[model samples]
Target: MEFSELLEQAGGAGLFQTLLLLTFILPCFMISFHVLLENFSASVPGHRCWTQLLDNGSVVPANITPEALLTISIPPGPNWEPDQCRRFRQPQWQLVDPNATTSSWNEADTEPCVDGWVYDRSTFTSTIVMKWDLVCSSQGLKPLSQSIFMSGILVGSFIWGLLSHRLGRKPMLSWSCLQTAVAGTGTTFAPTLLIYCGLRFVTAFGIAGIFLSALGLMVEWTTTSRRAVTLTVLACSSSAGQAALGGVAFALRDWQTLQLAVSVPFFAIFLISWWLPESARWLIIKGKPDQALQELRKVARINGHKEAKNLTIEVLMSSMEEEVASAKEPQSGLDLFRVPMLRKRSCPALVTSFSLLISLYGLVFDLQSLGRDIFLLQVLFGAMDILGRATTVLLLSFLGRRTILAGFQVMAGLCILANTLVPPDLQTLRVVLAVLGKGCFGISLTCLTIYRAELFPTTVRLVVLFFLPETRGLPLPDTVQDLESQKSTAAQGNRQEAVAVESTWF
Candidate 1:
């Protein structure tokens, strides 16, 4: 079926159904990709199939007289350094006898080799050892490849943000998905580390852009009342994706095979672009009133509302006008500081964004790289993240944004402090503290994302969100502004109420 028809069917079903499909499928794709990036063994260097063979080699058996012990010293060749010479002798020596004969040698020898050697059909046993220098040098490439991919994300975020604003969210999202598919597929065919890293960077750029645009489209399509729920659910897709990585990583254990596994999803999701509709908000903004009306009617029909056709351009324009008036102020970036209300809101949101990011991304990447059994850590952090999102959804009605945010910050800080202070000898307590810290950090991050979106006016929202200056006082371009705008808006309503109360009493 045509892509549009599939999307229409999916959208026509219900919000719950659409969310279920995306929640399930998108994360599966994402987790597979993440596993390939962070956990896939092929990305590690000096990991040729030969390494496994060497590790499985067994020592050849020898027949010696009862009083005679055969000892052969294998001299180091010209190519072997002192370090290389030592490894051949370091492995535990093993003796194998098909005849079941007994011999008087150390348990390290004469006994049937319990471990450390493999026997092939040729009756030869080999012991394999790796050259440490070669292994380290080969492993180093993986990090460089990952760094390239991250750099692409950093660049792609800005480019995609701009494109979504200029070209409309739907087109950008569709094109980005296609790019991701192509780049991802190409990655599986990379014959060299340089080629693999380059393709990965390209793939990352497309993936990053697709996510940014898709998120913006989803947010813009929903009503104000449902916005938080929709956004939170969408954000949860990322976590779900991380969870799926465990399975995908397990299935595609080899490096090249893993890359192929990762690429397949992007190709599948590309087909989704056909089914997805253009954003109703962007349609109205671009003066495509008829198309906007048609899309809105479809949503209304799915929602079982009778007023779908009645949602006129006039109503949309009025809403836009109100938003514009509310956001109207001096245009310069410095104007954010001129208003005390804006300043207060912006500062906390910005601080929370950076701090929460430091905790979340830093820990996640660190744990993944450590290559340890991190399931417990994952579950702990994942639960905390879900709980934090749920708390934001519930408490948004009762708690002021600033209060909730401040609480989150304090909780996170305490958890992190406990994580550092807990005695290392108390491994269980340390793990518990780490989980609490992760959970606290998760909630803080959710608060920041939700609060930021509510902070800015629609017209300048994207610009302010992506262009805001860093805590170090370094000014980024327009992209940071969009991120900053959300922070400012989240605190605006509370700050305004405080201002009004002060004015009445004064």
Candidate 2:
């Protein structure tokens, strides 16, 4: 019997499992919010260089309109768009620009903004852009800071993935939650850009750990019947978090306050971490059957099984010997590519994964293209995410994931393609189709993440691939022997059929 089967016998998809699933729901939302944080925090607001300059002791009037000031002290860019960086060395006074095109404009001496930029704070009261003047000559800092933040997530995924496997999931999850709470919330108070970026990395590291551990635990704790539904629910939780971020960002207006609002939730999660369970399946793999059995017995008791007290450790340990004996030598990531059939299948999957990722991020980064309130669009996008996952949950019983994936992908393509035919003046129709496309994309992304994890032969390298929410249904072949066993079974069936046909002819 496999460990999966033993877990099934011990009431895998019961009340205990539901309780365990609830423990991870908050962590799912917290980690997902980090993925969307940069859109608000690093956004460059409407800005123009302050034109005021002191000539000895005289003051330039402060009440001048921006248009008049720009004419006096700024040169339009080469395309006749207002220049973002350079300004005239000395004011020309608006009276000189009597004509739109004149020789004087061509020969005007210009210098970079010596007096820093002034930002319009109508929507965003404070952001990294407004606070640090990451505009004009320093515009590159906005994207650079974001790049550093993403790099932290990339590196953290590897470290936390390995650490959770070595140090156990619950401990890593607890520590991550606590660390993220401290480091992330503390970032709001950082007085310098360098310190903020440093804290952002720490926050990324901790959240990565929390995300991986919580997701792994969620999948491991549930039975196959419940795994997809649980993952779908977690996906919805993530969308809700993103929606909450959009709404809170709209309300708070200041980047620091929004930062604190999002970061503080993890501390509450740290306290709740006490209730989360370490993977009993992993415990059994580690030769801790006694501990695993205790966890299962508690599960059985919560599930209202009277026989739980009599359920000995043997029930959990029974499958361990076969698992250990059947285990193969560890394979590196390249091995998946070394196998011909695997590579053929993987190439298309890789391309598809890349396409899905680009489309997902492109939609997220450019949500305002739909011509609606950014806050409302984000909430609708989140709602669409919720709708898509919920729809997937309902369809899973009637449709295979592969079939549903194809349908959703096709729908996404059609929606996007149809939008191109929509007239530019028909903003409402364009917005509707775009929203539908986004929803289709949301569904496709959710399915692809889970599907690929199930598709791949588990190898050390593949561990770095799928990191969001997860579902566990099919077990990966642990050894080449397992494949050979399957081949032998097919061969024996073929032989039996041949014998039966000859017997019938005779």
In model 2, state the lDDT of residue 13: 69
Instruction: Please estimate how well model 1 matches the true structure, expressed as its whole-model Cα lDDT.
Output: 0.51
lDDT of 1 by residue, 98-152 (tens): 3323242333322221222221212111101121222333446545666788788
How far is 477's C-alpha from truth in model 2 (Å)? 6.5
lDDT of each: 0.51, 0.69
- Deviation in angstroms for 25 in model 2? 1.6
Off by over 4 Å in 2: 53-67, 77-82, 94-102, 307-310, 326-328, 331-350, 368-372, 410-433, 456-506
lDDT of 2: 0.69
By summed lDDT, the worst window of 10 consecutive residues in model 1 runs over 497-506
RMSD of 2: 7.5
TM-score for predicted model 1 compared with the true structure: 0.66
Model 2: ten consecutive residues of lowest lDDT:
497-506
Leading candidate by TM-score: 2
